[model samples]
Structures are given as C-alpha cells and as structure tokens.
Target: MNLAFIQNMGGGGIVTILLFSLAYFILWVYCLVDALRSNFKDPNMKLIWVIILLFAHGLGPITYLILGKNSKTTN
Candidate 1:
C-alpha cells in the first residue's frame, strides 16, 4: 500500500489498522502451520487447503480455523 496515504489517516486509525493487520497475519500463519502439521483423511485435502490458504487470503484461514481444523485425523 501507499505509506503516504496511511500517514494521512491520523494516529488512532493507523494504530488500529496496523494492529488488525498484524493479528490477521498471525492468524494466517498459525492456520498454515496447523494445516501443514495435521493429518487429513484424504491426502489431497491437505494440498487443497494449502492452495486455498495461498490464494484465498481473506476467508481461507478463517474458514479453515472454523471448519477444516475439525476434519483432520488424530494421531
């Protein structure tokens, strides 16, 4: 994004946006790692979810966290 535009948005808005972005990034990474380490019933399911995470930036991780996490096979 343009740093100039962000600078013009005032302090509180900037802080809130930065914090939300950071939190989102953390959640995305956590979901990616969790998907990688966990076993799924179908081998292709892992690949599918990974692809989803890679492409579907906004909703992919949230959907995985809410729905896909439960679909993993327990050791």
Candidate 2:
C-alpha cells in the first residue's frame, strides 16, 4: 500500500497510538477527579495537587497517586 493510503486508513501503529492516548487521557481524568474529591492534610494541598495534575500531564497524576497520597493521609 501507498504511504498516503496507509496514512488515510490509520495503519496499525496509528491505531495503537490512538488507543494509548485514550488510555492516558482516561487515567489523567481519573487522577484529576480523585485529587479533587480527596482531602489533604494541609487543607491547601488539594488545590496544589489539582494544579499539578492539570499541568504535569504524564507525571502529575502518578505523583499525586504516590507521594501526594502519603502527604494527604498524614493529616
């Protein structure tokens, strides 16, 4: 197949990439929502975590799930 045809059809790589993006988006949204709903020990930290999740893209949610959880639980 031609390059143009493959591009137009969204070949295997494209499909995989799209699926990965969708998964990442879902995970990010889940993290954002969780961060919003959760209570933090510091009181002010909930807003900070939400901002981090908003800007950090790949790492923000993961960080919240990890270190942020500990901080919040300590309260």
Candidate 3:
C-alpha cells in the first residue's frame, strides 16, 4: 500500500467519524432538552430520565420518548 492511498483512506475515515459524532451530539442534546421539558410531575423523574438518556445514548432517548408521561391532561 502506498503512502498516498493510506492518506486518502485516513481522510475519508476521519470525515465519516466526524459526521457520525456530530449527528450523535445533536441527538443527545435534543433528547436532553426533551427530557427536561417532559411532564412527569416529579423533578426527580425528569433528572433521572435526562441522566439515563445521556448515559444510554440513542436507546435511552427513544425509550423515554415512548414510555415517558404525557402531561396534557390530568385524571
């Protein structure tokens, strides 16, 4: 393998990694915001969800969005 080939491959790999990082960062931030704004009646629940989302990354956010409470109406 020539130095030129290696350099080109490295550059492409870096770009791909950077793009994935950016997307993940944006998703994390969005999930954090959504968890904070969620209506769970308890502040502790919100904090827990936010921390879970941050640590669990993609799966956590989706779980929170799907299972979290809806504060639109009271029973």
Candidate 4:
C-alpha cells in the first residue's frame, strides 16, 4: 500500500517488474518484426499495425497478433 511496504518486500517487486518488462519487450519486438514481414492483403495494414505497435503499448502487438494476420496463409 505504501513505499515502506514495497521496500519491505525486498527484491520480489523489483524482480517481478523486471520480468514483466522483459516479457513485454520480447513480445513487442516479435510482433513488430512479424508485422513488418507479414504480407497483408492491403498494404496499408502494415502501416496500421506498425502505428498500433508504436502507440498502443502492450495491447497493440497483441491486437496485431490476434487479428492482423493474413488468414489466407496456412502457416
């Protein structure tokens, strides 16, 4: 609830934060790269995904991964 409480938790909070940040970073990078390489039916979709990944933080990449893919591909 307070700074002292967080401090008393020692490395747990710091480790958790670091781990979450790392995971988010990895996910973001993966999504960005995938979006860049993806073949969208509409070329504008690539730009849209890039913009979303840039400004939407954790949710943007997720949205792209979930909904931005070209469904025509089997891979």
Query: Whole-model lDDT, candidate 1?
Result: 0.91
Top-down lDDT ranking = 1, 2, 4, 3
- Stretches off by above 4 angstroms in model 3 are 1-9, 41-43, 69-75
lDDT of 2 by residue, 9-57 (tens): 6578788889999998998999888888887878888889888999899
Report the alpha-carbon TM-score of model 3 versus the true structure.
0.62
Point out the higher-scoring one by lDDT: 2 or 3: 2
Candidate 4 residue-wise lDDT at 14: 85
Query: When superposed on Cα atoms, how far off is each prediction in RMSD?
Result: 1.9, 4.2, 5.2, 3.2
lDDT for every model?
Answer: 0.91, 0.82, 0.72, 0.82
For 8-29, candidate 1 gives per-residue lDDT tens digits of: 8999998899999999999999
Clashes of each: 0, 0, 0, 0
Most lDDT-accurate candidate: 1
Off by over 4 Å in 2: 1-10
Summarize candidate 4's per-residue lDDT along 1-75 as a digit string, tens digits: 457777776898889989999999999999999888877777687888889999999599788778877532444
Give residue 26's lDDT in candidate 4 (0 to 100): 96
What value of lDDT does candidate 2 attain over all alpha carbons?
0.82
What ranges in model 1 sit over 4 Å off? 1-8
Candidate 4 ranges with C-alpha deviation above 4 Å: 1-6, 70-75
